[model samples]
Target: MSSFKSYFSIIQVLLLFGYTGFFSCGAGAQQMASEVKEVKAPKLLFLNYTISKDTNGTYRATFINKVLTEGRLKDKTQRQPLSDAGDIVCIQYNDKNDVLDRSYIKNPLQPIVEYVNDDGNLEKRQLNLNSAQIAIKLQLQEATSSVRLFLIDASGNASTDLITTSIR
Candidate 1:
C-alpha cells in the first residue's frame, strides 16, 4: 500500500510539471508575438505627369518625379517622408477596373519609373538619381479609358495606405 501511494505521488508530480511547462511555453510564444511590430507601407506622391496617345494610337502615361513617403500619413499635419535613403517601391496600374500591370522597384534613389512595352506589358526601368524626372510609361488597353496607380514599399514592415491617383 505504501509503494502504491509513492507511485501515485510521483505520477501526480510529473503530470503537474508537464502541465506547467506546457503553459509556460505557450505564454512565452504569446509574449513573443505581442513584441513583434507591424510593418507599415510607404505613401506615394504622384507628381506632375501626363497620359498621351502615341503614333500607333496606343495610350501611354508617364509619371514624373513621384515621391515615396516612408511612414503612414495619419493626417495632413503628420507627414513622415523617408529621408536620406529610399525604400523598395511597388507600383500597380489598373485600367478599366482591371490590374493592367505591376512594377517593383528595389531601392530607387531616382524617380520610380514604369512603362508599358509594345507587347502591352508594363515594364519598370531604373534611372539615375540625378535625373530630373522618373517617367513611368503605361500602355493602355482597348476600352480602358482610365488608369489608377497604387504604391507600396516592398521592404517588409512598412504599412502604406492606398495612395491612388485620380482616374485618368
Candidate 2:
C-alpha cells in the first residue's frame, strides 16, 4: 500500500510538470521552425523594369512581377540567366535608368561573350555564379532615389509590374 501511494505521488508530480515541459519544448520548436522559414530564398520569376518620365523630369524605374513570398524585394542578388543557345542577355540598370552604365554578368553555363549592350560595354567585373546572384546585384541607390526592377526571362517572358526600391 505504501509503494502504491508513493507511485501515485510520483505520477501527480509528473502530471504537474509534464504540461509545462511539453509547452516549453513546443515553444522552442515553433520558434526554430519560424526562423528556418524566414531564411528561405525567394522564388525566381520573370519580371520587368518600367521607366516612366515623370512631369518633374525624373525617370522612375519600377520592378514588377513579384513572387508572393515574404522574401521578395529583400536585399538579395540577381543575375541574368543563360539562354538555350549558350548565349546570355545582360540587362543593366544603374542606380537610375541609365542603361548605358550597366555591367555584364558572366555566365558559367556558357561562354557568353556577347552578353553586353549592343554598344560594346561590359556588365559586372566577372564573378562566380551562385544562387544569391539576383539578390546581391539588385539593390537600392542613393543617387537614383527609387528604382524598380522587373524579371526578364531568357525567352523574354516578363510580368508587367514593378518592384520598387527607395535608394535614399
Clashes of each: 12, 29
* Model 2: lDDT of residue 13: 96
In model 2, where do residues sit more than 4 Å from their true spots?
37-168
Model 2 per-residue lDDT tens digits across residues 25-113: 99999999888744445432233433343454332344443322223444233333433321223343455467421222333322224
RMSD of 2: 14.8
| C-alpha RMSD values across all candidates | 16.3, 14.8
Per-candidate Cα lDDT values, in order, are 0.46, 0.42
Displacement of residue 167 (Cα, Å) in model 1 is: 19
